[model samples]
Target: EHKRTNMNEAIVEKLHGTLSILRRERDEVHRAKELAMERLRLAKEETERMERTLQASKQKYDALMAQSTNNSNSNSNNNCSNGSDGHGGKVNESVEIMQLKKEVERIGREAKFQHMEYVSKRDTLAKLKNHLKAEDAQRSKNIRIAQETLKKRRAKLANIQALARNHISTDGTSGGSASRGRANDNGNDSGISGGAGKGKNRTSASASAS
Candidate 1:
């Protein structure tokens, strides 16, 4: 009984230790999950800021394009007026218009490049968001698995405790029966010894009488 009790106590202690370790692991996983969520939030904010910047750039590009078109119309009117002045003025006007056209083309190219860059950045931000989402999902899955595992461990611990209780109870109930059986055996042995002793005395008496 003492040995069995010691064994059960050892097992319970070991299980409690394991439960503590598992709790620590669960806490760490929860912390990781919080960190991941924070990162996702920051990523979303950054993407929003980028989108706003891209929108502003697009608006600026559109305004510049409109101004360039207006400038082209104005230059055309000036050329028409200066055409009658002389070959020199016409040549100078044409050069000025060519320079203006070049400037407009350069601005258009810059706007196109800027738009492409914006698109690339947007795509990259989208991918980042997706990646963060996946990470969040994976973290959630890990937490759920951990929780399930913890539940199972608790259930196992409960079963171990129940079995231990049953074992102790059975030993307690049978203890009296075992003790009674031992006592009866001792009594039988004593009676047999006494009867043998009496038989020896009787033989001695008959021998003396003879």
Candidate 2:
């Protein structure tokens, strides 16, 4: 009866130990999940901010384009006005107007180029977001695989425990006999005082046979 009680108590202690290990594994998995979610949220926010900046650049480019068109119309009207006037100053004023129109056209082309640059930047931001998403997915998958591996290790540990229990139960009466066997295998030692001694010389012979 006492032996049975002792066995039951030992089993309960082992169960508690296994449960503790499982709880630790679960907490680690939860922490990893939280970190992944935080990264995903930050990446999404950055993508949205980039989109807003792209839209603002597009609006600025369109407004500059409209202003350039109005400038061109105004320059044409000034040329006509200069030709109709009889004053000697009108020819010089027309020449100045032509130069100003050239400058306006240059500014318009610069605005168009700036718009193209914004589009390229927006595309790059999109690619970054896609890459981040793929990385997040891969991280999540790896976490799942790790958790599964932990579960399998825990199961293997349980099996080893069971085998140990069976060995102890069945060999309860052979403790001294097993110790004698081990002592013979290792080469028996007797001592009144201790010092270094040669290890068993033929130890690897049995291992090599196997």
Candidate 3:
């Protein structure tokens, strides 16, 4: 009731306009989202199509390779009939023998390389062992040298400590003896002065009496 009487008409009109603008924005956002989803779906379909094409190409390549191998085999067995009469068993046997020869050569090469690698590794291991032994020997020698040096240093320190202690004791005894001697000399001087003072006083009294 209060809003009906007090509210401005222009403000109400402005609010209605703002609501309409907001509704348009909401619809635009929904359309943009739908477009994005559609693009995503199309991208997925394209990826699937590319994958299928790749598979077909791979199959075609395999077929070509197999056909080329068969042709090579057929050409190599020339003594056999040009057609399939004598070429049948001979072509298959030749292909098998060639495959076996290639496999055997590959195996032999691998074995040779493995043997060489083993020898190299063995030599390297031996060298490493020698190096480790040399290092151990040097470390032991250094340890012995360090121990001898430490022993000499300890002996020198002990001698220096003994000398310092003797010097300190001698200084303490000399100081005590000097102090006692000074005290005795001061007592003797005071006694002599007191005797002279008494003799003078006695002589002065005799003169006065006479």
By TM-score, who's the top model here? 3
lDDT of 3 by residue, 133-207 (tens): 565566556555655655665565556666767878999999999999999999998999999999999999999
Error of 3 at 110 (Å): 2.6
RMSD of each: 8.6, 21.0, 33.8
True lDDT of residue 64, candidate 1:
57
| CA lDDT for candidate 3 | 0.61
What local lDDT score does residue 190 receive in model 3, on the 0 to 100 scale? 90
lDDT of 2 by residue, 1-210 (tens): 445545655655665665566556656655765665565556556555555655565565556556656665676687688865334454555555566556556655655555555556556656665765666566566666656655666666566668777888878859888988888766644431222332343555666888
Kindly report which residue stretches of model 1 are placed more than 4 angstroms away from their true locations once superposed: 84-210
TM-score sort, best first: 3, 1, 2
Q: Compared with the true structure, what per-residue lDDT tens digits does model 1 show for residues 1-210?
A: 455556656665665666566566656656765665566566556555655655565565566567656666766787798873244644665565566556556655655565565556556656765766676666667656656665666666666677878988999889988999999999999999999999999999999999
C-alpha lDDT of candidate 2 relative to the true structure:
0.60
Per-model TM-score versus the true fold: 0.43, 0.39, 0.49
- CA deviation > 4 Å runs, candidate 3: 1-90, 206-210
Worst 10 residues of 2 by lDDT: 192-201
Best by lDDT: 1
Model 2, residue 44: C-alpha shift (Å): 1.0
Q: Model 3 TM-score?
A: 0.49
